[model samples]
Target: MLIISPQTCTEGFAYDRGSRRCIDEDECRTQPDVCRGDMQCVNQNGGYLCLPRRLYDQPYRSEIPARPEATAQCLLGYTPAEDGSCDDIDECETNSHHCNPTQVCINTAGGYTCSCTEGYWLIGGQCQDIDECRYGYCQQLCANVPGSYSCSCNPGFILNPDSRTCQDVDECEDEPCTHGCFNTYGSFMCNCDEGFELASDGTSCIDLDECSFSEFLCQHRCVNTPGSFSCVCPPGYYVYEDGRSCEDINECDTGNNTCTTAQVCFNFQGGNTCLDALQCHSPYVEVSDNQCMCSAENPACRDKPFTILYRHMDLSSGRSVPADIFQMQATTRYPGAFYIFQIKSGNEGREFYMRQTSNVSATLVLSRPIKGPRELVLDLEMVTVNNVINFRGSSIIRLTVFVSEHPF
Candidate 1:
C-alpha cells in the first residue's frame, strides 16, 4: 500500500504496478547470486531459500574443493543442514568428543570444550592429577584418584567414617600383644611383667635369666633357673639361713667318728683324731713303737699290748750293741703271776740270753756279737706258772730281727 518506486521491492519479491501489491519474488531465476555458492537458491512465496548440495559436504573450506560462490559461515561445532543453516553436532552425545573421562563435556557457541571437575585443575588441556597427600589432605595418608582423592591412615590407625580424618586403630583391643600393649602415634609397643622381658618380635614375653645378670643376690655358687636362682654349698658343710655362708661339721660330736675300743676319739675344730689307749701302770711310761717300761718311781709295768717291733742295727763291723730282745708284761686280772719262757726254734740260739726278772714279766737279751748283716728268726714259747686264775694267753711268739750295715 506504501509503494514508492518499482525498485523498492524486497530482495525476494517482485513489483506489480497494475495490482499495486507485493507478489512472490523468484530471485533464483533473476539474480543468480542471491545465496552462497556452496548453497543452491530455491524459489519461495515471499523469499528465496538456500539449500545444501552434495559438493558442500566438506567441514572446512579449502582451495582444492573450491566453490564458485563466496565462503560459507557455519556455527562452531556445527555443520550445515539441508536448508543451508548451521545446526548443533551433538558430538558428546554421539561419543565423538575427544574429552577425557576425568573431564566434563561443555558445548560452546561454536565448539565444545573439555574441563576438569571442581577438585581438579587444567594441565596441557587435561585434568591435572592433584596429589592430596602433598597437600596434607588426609590425616595420615592420601590416595589420588581420577578426579578426586581418598583418605587413609598409617599403621595402627584407621580412617574415620567421615573419610577425611583418622583415629587410633585400638590394636590392643584385638589382644595383639601377649604381654602388655602400649599404644602410641601410629604404632604400638609391648611391655613385660615383673621378672620378665619382651621378646624380639614385640608380641611375646620371655623369662629373664636372673642368675646371668651381675646383680644376682646369690653369694655362693649360683644355679640359674627360669626367672629364679639358687645358692648351694659343698658336701660335709652346712649352709646358713642366708643360703650363702657355710660352716664345717664336727663329726666326733655327731658320733660319726669310727673309733674302736682301744682308740680314743678327740675332736678339734673341724676334724677328730684317734689316740692310743693308756694301759701303763701309775709310774710306768709308754715308749716309742708302743712299748712299756719301768719308771724311776715305780719299776713295774702292767697290761702291755701284744706288739712286736723290729730294731734296726748296724752289723757291718760284725759286732752289736746291748739290745733288749724280748719283754712281756702281765695282762692277767690277778697280780703277781709266775711266767716261764723257752725258745722253740731259731738259727743260732746261743746268741741270745733269757732273764726271768719278776713273776709278772720277763726279758730276753741278745748277744752283742754277730757275724754279719743278716735277718734272724726266733720262736718263743711261754706258760703261766702258779697262777691264781688261768687267763687267756698265747704260748707262741715269732720274732724277726733285721740288722743292716748302714746304722739301721
Candidate 2:
C-alpha cells in the first residue's frame, strides 16, 4: 500500500484503499473557483463542493453578473428557487399571465400562455371571435358568440334536431280553409265570406251568383262580379214590386202619341193612328168650325144651272155618307121667288115653299127648312141671258143654313 504523507494532501484529494494511491478529487469545497460570489458551497464525500444558489438581496441586482454555478442559471419564464435551485412557476394556473378575459390558458414546459376558446382564434395573444357562419360551420345559419358560437334556423323555418338543419313547414297543408286557404310567407289565409269562393289562382275571392241558380231571389237577369252580384230588368220593362221583376208598359195610356194634322185618332192594340175622313169621296172637303169649304173653285155647267153639294159630318166619326141625293139645280131669273121643297112621305108627296126672294149674290140662301138630314137635290134651269154668263159658264155656290128642331 502506498501511503501519502500528510503534507502532500492537496485540497479535494482522496486515498484509494484498493490501489493504495491518491486520486484527484473535486476542489469545489476548498476553492472558490467552482461557485460564483453569489453562490454558496456544499461539501461532498470525496471533495468539498460549491452549491449554486441566489441570495435574497434588499435591492435586487439590476444586471445579472456572470456565474459559474450550473444551478444558478436563470431559465426563460422562471427564476431560481429560494433554496438556490431552478423551478417553474405556473403562470397560467395562478392567472399571473396577461391575456384577454375571454381567452383560455395553456401550460408549457417552463411558462404558460393564453389562447382563445373553441370556435375562436388567438391573434397577438388576444382572443378574437371567429365567424363560423362564413366557414359553413352551422347546418342552416350560424351566429357568433363571445368566445363561442351557435347554430340556428332562418326565418320561416324551424330547426330539425335530428338533422341539425332547417326545414320548411307548409302552412297550406293543414286544411286551414274556411272557404279556401292560401300559403304565404310563413303563414296562411282563408278566403272571403260565405257568399264568396276562392279564385282558381288562389289569391282572390269572387262572389257566387245565387240569383242565377235560384229564381226566388232575383226575378230578372243576374250579373256576377268579383265580390258581388246584381239583378237587372229587361229593356222596355220597369222593375216590379219585388225590385227585380219586370212589367210591361202601356204606351197609349202613358200619353205617348205619334199622329199628324187634321186626322182622327183611333186607339189600337199597341198604338194609335190618324184617318182621313173624306178620302173616299170624289170631292173631298175638310170641315173647319162646322163649315165645309169646296176644295175646287168652280164646277162645269153643261146646259143651264150648276149645283154644288156639301156633306155635314163629324170628322172623328168613322161612318160614311150615302151617295144618291146630290143633283143639278133649276133657276130662271136672278131673284125670283126662292123656295126649298121637302118631300114629306113618299117619292111624289107634299111640298113646302118660301115666299121671299133675296138679292142674287155669291152666297145662295135656302128658302125653306128641310125636315131631316137627307141628300140635297137641286135643278137649276136658265131663264134668259144674263151678265153672269161666260163661254165656260162656270159658277161656285156657297150655302149657309140655320136649322130649328121642333118636337113632333
Candidate 3:
C-alpha cells in the first residue's frame, strides 16, 4: 500500500545507487574507532557493541553469535574432522597438555584433566610424593618411594604372607645354646643344667667347681669331678653310710693287723700295734700279761731289775714332729717314793725323749721326723727311791717300735 524511495532507507540499512535498493550496514568494520579501551566490537543484525576482550575468544564454546540453525567453526581444544564435524582434541597423545611430568592426563569432551599417579597426590598444581608411613601402611615399618611404597618388619620378626603384618621368630629352634635354650617373644635365652654354670659367651656350659665354694662338703678331703664332687677319707678310716662323714676302722677286730702268733694285736686311733707275749727272763718269772717279778732264790737277782715289762708300738712315716706316742703311769701309788725315769738305750738318733708329768706319770715324745722300714728296741728304766725307808729299786720296760713305709 506504500511506495518507498531508495534514498529513504531504514536506521540499520544503507542506500545503494547501483542496486536501486537498501542493504544492512557493517558498523563494526566501517567504524574502525568505535570500541573503547580493553574492549572489542561485535557486529549484530541491526547494531554492534563493545565487549570485554576476554569474552571474545572463549575456548570450547561457539565464538560467533547465536543465529537460526547455524553452526560455529572449531575453537581451541577441538579439531575439524573429515566429516565436517568437530571432535575432541587428544592433548595427551600430542603432548600438548599442561599436566606435570609426574601426573596422568585424561582426555575429556573438549579438554584434558591432570591427576596424580599411585603414591602421589596433587598439591598446588603439582604431583607430590605421598607419605604412606603416616597412614600406617606397614605393621612394623614403612618406606615410601617414587610412585610406589614398600612394607617391612622390624628385627627379630618376619613378614607375614600379606606383607603388612609381622610374626615373631623362634630362635630356639636352631639350638644355639649348649645345655638348654628358651624362646621368648622376640628373642632367645640360654641356660645351664644342675652342677654347671653358663659361660661368658652365653652359649657354652662350664663346671661349677663345687669344691671351691665350701670346705665342709667333705669330711676329710674334697675331690672335684666333672659335674659332681666327692668326699675322701684318710687311711685307717672309712666313709660312713651318710657318704659325707668318716669313721675309724679297727684293724685288730678285722684281723687286718700283721702280728704273728708270738705277738698280740692291739688297736689305736688310725693304726694298729703288735706286742710280744709275756715271757720270763733267766732271773724273773712271768706273773701276768704285762708284769714280771725277779726270783729271790737267785742271789744275782738282787743287783738286777726287780721286774721287766714289754711293750710295742706302730708309727706312720712322715708323722708330724713333737708327737706324744706313749703314756706311762705307776700301777700302785706309794708314800714318800721319789721316781726318776730315763731312756737307757735305743735312742741313737735322739728322736725321742721322756717328759715326767707328775710323780707317778710320764710321757714319751718324738721330736724329729722318723721314716719307716726300720725297727727300734728301746729300754726305758724307772728308779724308785724311798727316802723315808732307805730302799731303792729299779724297773725296766723293753719297748719295740715298728715304723711303716707309707704316710696313709
Which residue pairs collide, candidate 3? none
Estimate TM-scores for all models. Answer: 0.37, 0.30, 0.62
Ranking by lDDT: 3, 1, 2
Put down candidate 1 lDDT per residue, 111-164, tens digits, no spaces.
Answer: 455655656554555566555566676777788886567887777787899998
Candidate 2: worst 10 consecutive residues by lDDT? 399-408
lDDT of each residue in 312-357, candidate 3, tens digit only: 7777767898999988767765799988888989999999999999
For candidate 2, write residues 132-168 as lDDT tens digits.
5655656777777765557777775777875357777
lDDT of 3: 0.76
Tell me the spans in candidate 3 whose CA falls farther than 4 Å from its real position.
Answer: 1-95, 106-113, 121-145, 148-155, 160-167, 184-186, 197-225, 231-237, 240-248, 255-263, 268-276, 295-297, 312-325, 366-378, 397-408
Q: For candidate 3, what is the TM-score?
A: 0.62
RMSD of each: 26.9, 29.1, 19.5
Query: Looking at candidate 3, what is the lDDT of residue 61?
Result: 45
lDDT of each: 0.59, 0.47, 0.76
Q: Enumerate residue pairs that collide in model 1.
A: 76-110, 77-110, 312-408
